[model samples]
Target: MAESIRTGRRKPAGPLAYAALVAASLFAVGPLLWALSTSFKSPDAVLTDTSWIPSAPTLENYTIVLFESQVPRYLFNSVVVAGATVLATLVLATLGAYATARFRFRGRGASLFFILMTSMIPGIAILVPLYFLAVEVGVYDSYLGLIVVYTAWQVPTVLWMLRGFFQTIPTSLEEAGRIDGASDLRVMVQLVLPLAKPGLAAAAVIAFVYVWNDYLIAATMVSSDDKRLVSVGLYNYLSQYGIEWGQLTAAVLVTIVPMVVLFVLMEKRLVAGLSAGATKG
Candidate 1:
């Protein structure tokens, strides 16, 4: 009877389910495939050939973007800014989250709420003020300005995420550390942080991606081409004469490579980190 009930409850795979999955996959990857096709086509072919498969493919676009343009510089700038932002956000968020998770204090709930609320405020709303502030503070048109803004914007969300992850950690571990005469700071550094590696890895990837992809702050904060990020640097392909679609698409594909590589390498940790807090709160 139990075997019959289990068989009856199992849903059979349907053609419609398979069809929907294929359609969704195409919809998501369609643009990327088109861009890849465009990047391989020559200048004239890009406009004349509307077919998904290019009639004639060339390496000219890749050659120009890699060696002839400022894309490499822009890429370096993005890496620096994103890396620094991740480090700063993790440090600040980890400390703040640890305090919130371990210590019982007055206004803790209110403080966490306020921090999360800051993230809810649309970044666009403060663009002008941030621009003026960066200028007034002497950090305008510099990597420092971009890193500082990105760190400030990312910290609140990361703090809340980490706080949840910290809660999921057992208090008995910390108690054991205390029994060994370890200081709170040492306990956190040695015991808590090592266990929270997955959460930290997840947070770092998120913060890194945010800074790397942001266009507005990179554009508004830094006017110099030398300090421009990859997102804003892509605009260089558009000139008064016309747009270089082939080169632009090639650059786009190249820019996506780093993120793809990162996701591939950190997929496991990211999944674990994201799910770790789900059961706690």
Candidate 2:
């Protein structure tokens, strides 16, 4: 009788919960779908009506954005600058993190905390000084300038993150390497690094994404249109006459796809890295 009654009854979440889930899903995907629809839409349709999908989808926007506009150059610049920034951040942050983690030096906590405090400062606050320094160093208006700027800004967070990750690594591993007559560098390279792979992957992904999407430093540091990164390049789509909604949407979506693909491919590694330290700690 109990089993028969249970079979007749319905499952939980009758109305409100299901509605909320459906609404949340739509909310998250709506904008992306809209952008994709807009990218293929006619300029007239974009302004005239609000439709989820384009009535007459076209590839003209992509063609014009890729061939006629400076979008390709901006894409190239973003890749170069972001790539360089990530590489620099990884090397500097990893070394600093290792030192902070393994060695008990004077004012270590104070230094780490102070370094982290800079994250709270708005980029606008230091823009003027950074611009002046860029000119002084003769790297202004150059890819190197933007890369260096991003590296400096992003490294502190990476250092803090990696320091925590490095700390979570078991000391016994290093001690074992020492027992086997391995040098400190060898231990770090062979054992410690191998164990900390997940953390490094997470840090790299974070650094790459931050630098790729950075706009403030890119705009201030790179003056030449040819050297502009994607974020600033999008501003060019706006004009006094009107905004090129279709072209701009196409450009934005194309710009986002690569990073999205990159993240999706490495998401597993990134999650593992983020959890590795936390789980151990």
Candidate 3:
């Protein structure tokens, strides 16, 4: 009776709210279901089939994309680029965030403001300068150029997440480490990192997804076929004459699966990180 009264005190979600939620869900999921449906159909059936269920579903599209195309190589390239970006961002952001969280120095506010500003800057504003710099540095069409750009772009996310997490942590832990003769770097790597797992995981996964799915920078910076990231490589199915809808949909589904799996695996930590990062010290 007490629980019922407490529940009753809360405002009831009206029918309009539920309707809007259902509509939004369909808006997001309808395309995904259609893509999944299209991926299973043969080229002829793809056009003819209005129904979601295929008359004869097959793995032929996936098979062709995986075995007969450069898609696997593109996947590997994406992995390398994303991995490199994550590593680079982690290294830079850890030092920057730790310093920002732990120290009070000249221009500290300005520095943080600058970091936030950079994150807000539009990609288009920097694209031309980055492209020219890449060409001049001979990293155009090279993984190094994209890795560098992605690293710079993603560092602010980690900084925001890690700095907030670091602030929430008890400074006594670092003091204890120092008393035991551990250096700042040692305390960070051995002690602090273990506790900041949620933030780190959140940051790394966000970086991975951003780098993996990014098209503008990757497509603009690199023009070579073999060096193409998965997002750019998906365009291989398109021609001036027609679109390979089956292959395109199959590729899209395949590209989405890994990120979904990664998110599911780290969902708890991601939620924790986002919540903690939302609040300032």
Q: lDDT per prediction?
A: 0.91, 0.85, 0.87
Better of 1 and 2 by lDDT: 1
Identify the runs in model 2 with alpha carbons over 4 angstroms from their true place: 1-21, 278-281
lDDT of 2 by residue, 197-260 (tens): 7888898889889988777888888888989899988886656226878888898888988988
Give model 1's TM-score versus the native structure.
Answer: 0.92
For each candidate in turn, the TM-score is: 0.92, 0.89, 0.88
Question: Which regions in candidate 3 have their CA more than 4 angstroms from the true location?
Answer: 1-24
- Backbone clashes under 3 angstroms, per model: 0, 1, 0
lDDT of 1 by residue, 1-281 (tens): 74577468789769999999999999998999999999999999999999999988899999999999888899999999999999999999999999999999999999998998999989899999999999999999999999999999999989988998999999999999999999999999999999999899999999998998898888889999899899998886566227889989999998889888998899877877888763466
Model 3: which ten-residue window has the lowest total lDDT? 235-244
Candidate number that wins on TM-score, 1 or 3: 1
lDDT of 2 at 99: 86
Error of 2 at 108 (Å): 2.0
lDDT score, candidate 1? 0.91
Per-residue C-alpha lDDT of model 3 across residues 99-215, encoded as one tens digit per residue: 999889999899999999899899999999999999999999999999999999998878877899888888898999999999989998898888877778878888998998788
Clashing pairs in 3: none
